[model samples]
Target: MPVPSQRYVRNHLLSILSPDDYEAIQSVAEGVALGRRDILIAANKSITHVYFLESGIGSEVAATPEGRRIEVCITGPEGIVGVPLLLDVDRTPHETFVQIEGDAVRVEATAFRRLIEERRLLRGIFAHYAYVAHLQTAGTALSNGSHTLEERLARWLLMCHDRVDGDEFPVTHEFLSTMLGVRRPGVTTAIHSLEGAGMIKARRSHVQVLDRDKLKAAAGDSYGVPETEYRRLLWARR
Candidate 1:
């Protein structure tokens, strides 16, 4: 485990922090490789650390005892994994896990809490970012309640596209089904619909964005609001 250097940073929130703020984080951070399905925060358990992704995507999933779960929030390289900890929470019913394999620099929960306590400005910055994260989750809830399957899928893919380094990403029907809280067959149908409209191209286990505007159109108003808020709240000054 090498120390995470501030020289290389892709997590947008971390990138925006002042030099001293970032240096404080580096003092407590260590680079880690994350694999798909790696649990960062288990439901009902005390959080051990907070992960700031340098690449790939993570998910905060809501689950029921009946064995149903849905991704309520998506954490890309632009976000952090342990958001509830910022609100002084140590545990939550929602589980946070890696949705795609990638790299991250994580800080132990105690050290990070101490850092925030000592640095008021950094805490303010994180609070604004936390609000942006909240907006994304709210957007997911709104889409799940009011959008069609195609619209929802389009929005999800667009979000993924934004996070990935390129237009193409590895995904499967089973994975998409789990994320969207839909059946495998329904995800297939939605993929075909997006392909038919020329917004995306899908093969056996991957999808590529062909036309971003078209995907946005397919998503209608269900997408972009949270993205807008993210930019306004987090990236406006930077």
Candidate 2:
């Protein structure tokens, strides 16, 4: 019910906008609290609003008719939700939901569409973000297809850690399994392996990064390319 402070406006895409461009949309943007597992964009449904996360993580998931789900990409303050709207689409087959509780700045989809059309810089920022999202999705596909469970889990943890404010966050084996499209036992085993290697410490319903460098090593080449690309495209000038 209260207004979000300027400090809460940490979404990278929004932050990179020129001051004039940001102010143009600020009047229409409303802050909202997002709860864990909150559905932001439902598959096959028209998107009503687009969210620029101020904190926490969102998962873009792909589902099959058999009710199986696999995460295609993870977004946080570094990205935006409702990407299909940017591509001139009204709906998508992929669903997006909050993987952790956080806050976001939201704008009506129509307003957002209009704003981008009227502002070249804003439109360019969103275009860059969409390309980064594509790279992240591609990275996920490569990880899922080629990496080991432990390596993939490490990569996921590194991604989450980059988005959160601290070294630790709450996550369960079941949730990890669903995100990774692996069995629960496989997630458990991977968690233990990371913990044993001192790459992370797992507790009840949480995981903490102990040695990020080692974790990156465990993730091998699956973790850094998209991150480097994001920084190059979006954050370098800032």
Candidate 3:
């Protein structure tokens, strides 16, 4: 198969690869369209492929036996979806799915594993990304335990904004509640609070960031730690 042109590769993780490393796996990579709610990885299921998002967002979620699900981390173009593959695991305990409609570059799991084994830099990058992803998960846990609902909402909005293209993005109270592990009423109330504060504009199924600085202020110390760590670990290395 023909390799995709560099100009067409928007995924930050793929873009940062050295030319040789990028080409090493390029022939096996295929572009795919992702829909909202598309399951990329199902808990305990053997992963068939690994995805590098070109746009949109995905959520890593944990579920209870009762089927209650809550997002543990959000991934965008900056990261890959199949972390278990990098860790030499065939299945993951958590599920991952697209939160927004977008496109991705996907490669068969076997091909990806072969590339990782052959490329030292690619292996190092995946390891670094996995660490960054873990930090994000830890930050989410800490914020949920310590921060107020409004503050957590602010932090989530900021994270979403960083991944999306513009000030506005498609989201809903139900979705927000699911991601934050809160009730819908609580998310509704928090949205109103942020809207009243002029930090954001809430529409029927979307939220627009009006003032990111104010949003960060609302989030307090619950936000930025993981982001800073990402820049330090990945951007510096890049």
- TM for candidate 1 is 0.97
What are the per-residue Cα lDDT tens digits for candidate 2 across 88-203?
A: 99899999999999999999999998998888878888888899999999999999999999999999999999999989998999999999999999899989999999999999
Give lDDT per model, in order.
Answer: 0.90, 0.91, 0.91
Kindly list the per-residue Cα lDDT of model 3 for residues 1-238, writing each as its tens digit.
2336765677878878888888876888888889999999989999999999889999999999998888899999899999889999999989999998898889899999999999999899889999999988999999999999999999999999999899999999988898888899999999999999999999999999999999999999999998998898787765
lDDT of 1: 0.90
Candidate 3 Cα outliers beyond 4 Å, as residue runs: 1-3
RMSD for each model, in Å, please? 1.1, 1.2, 1.4
lDDT of 1 by residue, 1-238 (tens): 5645556687888888898999999888998999999999999999999998999999899998997989999888888889888999999999988888899989999999999989999999888878988988899999999999999999999999999998999999998899899999999999999999999999988899999999999999989987898888887857
Error of 2 at 235 (Å): 0.8
lDDT of 3: 0.91
